[model samples]
Target: MSWKVTFRIYYEDTDAGGVVYYANYLRFLERARTEALRALGFEQARMLQENRIAFAVRSLSVDYLKPARLDDLVEVSSAVRELGRAQVVFQQQIVRAGEMLLDAQVRVASIDPVRGKAVAMPKEIREKFKTLMGTPA
Candidate 1:
């Protein structure tokens, strides 16, 4: 299943031309993922404190199809496309109303903060991600 979150475009999210700055989309996507995990009962802060595990973007690719303007309400949707022992690939999109504004794929890796190395996610976390991978969006 896909997880979704909505955000309102603000003046700070846009350029002088009133269109969302390209880089800001990354921030929006990050928030969507963070909220999705939070909704699943996996708080990032707690995960770090308890498991010493943090997720970092391993790779990302985005296709900008349309621009979102200031004052627009946009929705970001994310679904698990692939799940690995230590990483997940997410299929994501940003939409305005029913129209798509951007398409992206983001790969996130579980890492050991102190060692600064990729590590397998805890079993409970992997199982939780499996639920997202199996459901239909």
Candidate 2:
């Protein structure tokens, strides 16, 4: 299933032209993914502090289709496209009033925060991601 979160574009999020800065789209996508994980019963801070595990973006490709203007309300949607032993591929998009604004595919890898090395996700965490992957978006 897809997880969605909405954000309002503020002046701080925009450039001099009043359009959302391109880099802010990454922040929107990150927040959506974090919220999605929270909805699935995992908290990133707890995961890092207690389990010593943190997630990092391995790679991403984004397409900026349309610009979002200041004061606009945008929705960010995220879904698990693929799940692996220590990583997941997320298909995400940003939309405004039903119009697609951006499309992205992000690969995230679980890692040991201290060592900064890739690590296998705990069994429970992987299982939860599997469930998400099986659900319809």
| Cand. 2 Cα-lDDT | 0.91
The per-residue C-alpha lDDT of model 1 at residue 54 equals: 100
Q: What TM-score goes with each of the models?
A: 0.96, 0.95
Error of 1 at 96 (Å): 0.4
Q: What is the C-alpha lDDT of each candidate?
A: 0.92, 0.91
> Model 1's lDDT to the true fold?
0.92
Off-target runs (Cα >4 Å) in candidate 2 are 134-137
Candidate 2 lDDT by residue in tens digits, 32-88: 999989988999999999899999999999999999999999999888899989999
Error of 1 at 34 (Å): 0.3
**TM-score winner:** 1
RMSD of 2: 1.5
